[model samples]
Target: MSGDLLATDIEAYLDAHEQKDLLRFITCGSVDDGKSTLIGRLLYESKLIFDDQLAALEADSKVSGTQGGDLDLALLVDGLAAEREQGITIDVAYRFFTTDRRKFIVADTPGHEQYTRNMVTGASTADVAVILVDARKGLLTQTRRHSYLVSLLGIKTVVLAVNKMDAVGYDQSVAAAIDADYRQFASGIGLDDVTVIPISALRGDNIIETGPNLSWYDGPTLLEYLETVEPVGAATGGPMRMPVQWVTRPDPSFRGFAGQLVAGSVAPGDAVRVLPGGQTSLVERIVTADGDLDVAVAGQSVTLTLADEIDVSRGDVLAAAAEPPAVADQFETSLVWMSDQPMLPGRPYLLKIGTRTVGVSIAQPKYKINVNTMEHTAARTLELNEIGVCNLNLDRAVPFDPYEVNRDMGGFIIIDRLTDVTLAAGMIHFALRRADNVHWQSVEVHKEARAAQAHQKPCVVWFTGLSGSGKSTIANLLEKRLFADGRRTYLLDGDNVRHGLNKDLGFTEADRVENIRRVAEVSKLMVDAGLIVLVSFISPFRAERRMARALLEEGEFVEVYVDTPLEVAESRDPKGLYRKARRGELVNFTGIDSPYEPPEDPEIRVDTTTMTPDEAADRVLRVLRERAILPSAGG
Candidate 1:
């Protein structure tokens, strides 16, 4: 064919595909259960694979094919070299194909146990899941795992393909037994709509076309069902929610909020509310690139112009005024942990929902669900590939719905702030009652009044350094000196507070973080009480220290780093911790096994090697006087 003729044909095909409705589905099962082969067969039988691609598959199959002297259909979707060589799918491979009836995008996901996160990613958007079961093996552990994940992701439709029928001699009884067992299991998991089919993906039986061998099975073929199943319905006529992606203002006159409508519809004159602030406005115009739209429904990208100039920006959600989503700074959520680092409570991460990103911290895990048994086991932390229930505390309030109500508004991702890697995917269950009910009560006597009454500035002197670095000794002497000078002060020694407030916490990284968090909160309360709070602890992590600093007013939390060399501190070994660590009896010992991150820009740096404890206390007091934290010596 001529180049122009080929171009015309391709253009025509593309146009047809654009016109057809799309159905996104996923294929998953145990490893080597022919998931890739089933998808590859669908593409091959539908004539979607190009001639050159077919030629390449044939060439590659001769050396790496699992099947001898036959085209390895699995090679088509298992595109990774390692996958092709290992005869297993390692990642989710998505392929788009169109039949005469409809257009389909299928995700062939990995079936291995370790790749559950990959499966969750692919299934998150799928309308239906086709779970392949090896006929000889029947139902395996991974089959149940993938099935549970599919259900958890809200995939309503399920197709259980009993594959490798040829290997089991196409026996109807074997297929029947497996189908009965799966139906029983699926019912228990709330999977109501399930269709079972017997097929041999390797032999291409009952996949694209029905074969005489499976004449006993009277059901639609896989392609027939895929082409006919209804596409997942859009959230039209629901409460409108459009998370602002960009604030488009090219010229002085035009200011529009641009985003895809995730739910409901909007037209000119419709009332909308900007969320988390509850600012109401009328839709002045629905702007599109071509022209102004009369109406914009779910899934359409449009810019909205408000009748009134309100506080609207990127990361803000615009919702239907009457049915706006709930605004809260805390939520109970189900999380799928995806990172190798275990989730630690009180450690801040980035929570991204819709287009908005906010500082968030996951509370301790309520429980973790064992996918194999569906048992809820109590857990403190979530490791890789685990699912758990936990509370998420956001730095500020944001609008959202329950995941059951609106996936787009309720779904979120937790990102590591420093590494920028996605650590987990979460779905909001409900907002915590405390988030709405707990309000700071206004008091007539404020911080200034309390400080004036005490005759000293309310401050928290935070002493952070390595163990045996004399932080506690210097802080004790400093508190004694301040008390002698008529300053109202209290020293919160680390070991003393740990016995009562942080008694349950150990020396693990996570426990240490929680320990510091509790102490920081206590110090903030003490500062509010107009007392000089001296906190002497080996607060190691910089992030946690910064968190403490953020909780205080400007210049209120003074970080005092006791800069003693590690050699000197270790040689001193006042607590005998370094000796125990050297004997391998102590784990996560700071300055020995675990890290001790010193303050980079502390307000005061006291070198213990150059000064005695009393001298260090004098130096701190002199700095306080210079900073006006204390009254002048003469005054």
Candidate 2:
């Protein structure tokens, strides 16, 4: 294969088809994973670069690379100066190439675990991903993370390219072992039809030609695989996905909406429905920049004129007439946190899903998956690189499908509202509806009527304390007092309430906040029932307590700070949680593994070390009376 295909018909072919049939593939690997070298090798061996391009690469290579002469593939895509200095891929560099069969666009992304977000950007539109694992070393933690994210971003095909096989003596057993491990992880994540091939990108073994060193291996060479690899599937199922890019008026006489079809297909005169506002229209024409077309398939960018202009705008999708996406204001999502800063729940951010961008809040952290063990642990908050499930509350919901089923509409990005930095990338699970069974029990009266019935007035007594600060004891006593007084009352104790009511929840900062929010809502309902509610849990963050207060009517929720000195709480160690926390036996444990942010101006403060449980209960009762949420115990 002479590197002179540019002189042949290949050049003209690429120029013609790249306008419509460009399929992009990106290579991702950690620093020293040979991403740039692999690409440079591909381009060089493929005869894609001209003499001048090769000369420039050689000249630039002398000044940039670590060894000081060979044009490192890393230099080709590491366009940033910081990246060159640090010797890593930082930005998503778009590279172009062409094979005999297809025009190609490649986005070589970064590999450092911290730079995982770059992978999201590159792979967002990728049809195929080539993930590199060092042949001698096998799969690392970052390997699994990258693979998981590749699946998350909806890349349909994955090539587990085991590079540097020569380093391991072209050992079949080593390659087979790594391949087996990757297959297990990929299968566990439900990644479809993965291919693993062993190759030495440096020595050109099994890359473009058959290597004599590996007679034991019988597989298609990398170039042969690329030639035959079909990027898109034979079928794309259901509902046309046309993300409106712009509304164009070439002439006032004719107006059309333009965008690319992410999936499905559209034909002239086909019935289409526009969302998030449902309005039906007929497709008058499928217009391309060059001319009008009768039909367009998935991935073809085209414009269409509606037979009648009822209403349409950018950010709205023109879906198929039947089986339009479900409109939702809330959704369940699986999020992979990529930012260094921890995700702030209850805070607003811009959610960019498809062409639509809406404001959203992190409402619930369902569970955190322990990647190493593949165990689902309860989550309260997601830290850097943590993956979890959460309920995303959008200011205005859009129609969506579960990520497992639809990649175009299911994947989304959360950008920090303040910084505009991309925070996390996620997949949608389902929409949340108010129509779901209300856990709030039957009431013969309305909320106002229920409030009137519990003459003492209903309110939530939210307890804030260290792990062993006697919160549950005081709450139990307070509940007994309210129940004895014949006042409608309920105690939402931590361990007890969690058993059935919140058995599904786990202990992460996001989950902890979610746990409190659910508890607060239940407390709010009980309060509306005109009950005196005692919520005895260590509601840590001040932000969460303030939110609880905001949910209640004026003076209806009481925030109590149970200030037991850390030393004293540690000494009492009733649950041995502190000892475990100290020895690092716990993960993300507050007051030890994590910093516990204490409250400043809580409504009531009780020094549990000095006050008896009865005294603490009395102190809480006093606040309830102060708010008129309770009468004297005898009343």
Candidate 3:
């Protein structure tokens, strides 16, 4: 064709595409379930591939094709070199295509167990999930997992495409059996809107056109179903919520809050509330790049100008005043663990919800859901690809709705602070009762008044070291020295406290984290009472120690690292923990089986190889006196 003719054709296509409704869907299932092939066939049959691209695909298929002497339709979607070589999708590959009736955005997600995170990422924004099940293999574990994730992500529509029907000899009984089994399992998990269809993606059966072999099966093809399905929108009728993405100030006279409306609708003269800080204002105008909008519904990007000046900023939510979201610092949530590192309770993470980011910690899990068996098993932590129901405590309260009610307001991602990697995706179930019910009781005698009476500064001397490294001995002597010097002091030794306070805890990483958290809280209370608190524990993890440090005031919480060689500590092992660990009798024993992350920059370091316990105590006391935590010698 001539350039002018091609340009005219492209313009016509763009105009028609602009007018078509769009559907975003995902194809996911177990490995070898033909998800890629089904997508490739859909794109090919729709005539969306250009001639040159088709030629390249044909050539590549001949060189590295899974099927011999035939065009590999799966090559259209599986663009990665590793995917083409291994004949499986390794990452979520997105493609766009259009029919005369509707436009489509399909995410071909990986089917392997290790790429469950990739599947979750794709399903998070999808309105529908097309889970391809192998006809010969039926529904596998990954199919169940992906379906459960789809349900968790609030996707209401599901199409179970039973692929590879040719391998099963186009047997209607096999397809029916698999469909019945999947529907039964899906129904139990509250996935009620599921449509099952049989297809052979390799043979182009029941994809874009009805196959003659499946004459007994009377249903729309996959493409037809996709084009005809109702477009799911955000909960626009419930409440208006737009997280402020930017504070737009293009000129001296104009200022507006810009963001996509995730829920409800906003118009000029609508009453709105700025959340986390309950400031009310009226919407003065809705500005957009296309000029001004009289009204904007959910999913529209617009800048909103408030009638009255308010302290609205990025990370703040603008909501309908009549039906504002809840504000709470604690919530019960379900999280999908995505990282290689297991979720550790009491460890700090950066929790990002909407545009807001805050410090958060995941508490011990209530239970872990087994996707295949649907069993709720007791679990303390979530490993990679595991899903668990847990409680989360945030650094501050923010406005949010339950994920089931409003996805954008309730969904969040946890990021590792040090690595900056996304660790998990979470959906808020509900705010905890304590978040609303708990209130701080005011007291007249504060720490300052008590410190004046005690004639010393309040602080916590945290002593952390390996087992048999003399942490308790040094702390015990240090407390005695402080007491002898006319200063009020209290000693919280690990073993003594474990016998009473932390008796239910074990030696696992999670249990150890909780144990240290309790000790830190108690130490905080003691310091508030204007007593110098000496904490002696083999707190191995730096993250937990940092958590403890964060709970106290600036000058308080002095970290005293007791440095001892592993061989020396093992030789002096009074508890025989090292011996037991060596014999495989004890698991999660720090310095033997478990890891010990020593503090990189402690305030005080005591090497027991050279210094005696009394000398260590004197060094601590000298430092305390030098810092004015206690009075100098004679004074």
Q: What is the C-alpha local distance difference test score of each model?
A: 0.90, 0.79, 0.90
Clashing pairs for model 1 are: none
For model 3 the local lDDT of residue 82 reads 94
For candidate 3, the 10 contiguous residues with the lowest summed lDDT are 1-10
Model 2 agreement with the true structure over 451-509: per-residue lDDT tens digits: 66666777788888888888888888888887777778788888887898888877776
Span of 10 residues, lowest total lDDT, candidate 1: 228-237
Q: Please estimate how well model 1 matches the true structure, expressed as its whole-model Cα lDDT.
A: 0.90
Q: Give lDDT tens digits, candidate 3, residues 333-416.
A: 999999998998988899999999999999999999988788999998999999999999999998999999888999999999
Clashes of each: 0, 13, 0
Off by over 4 Å in 1: 1-12, 231-237, 609-615, 633-635
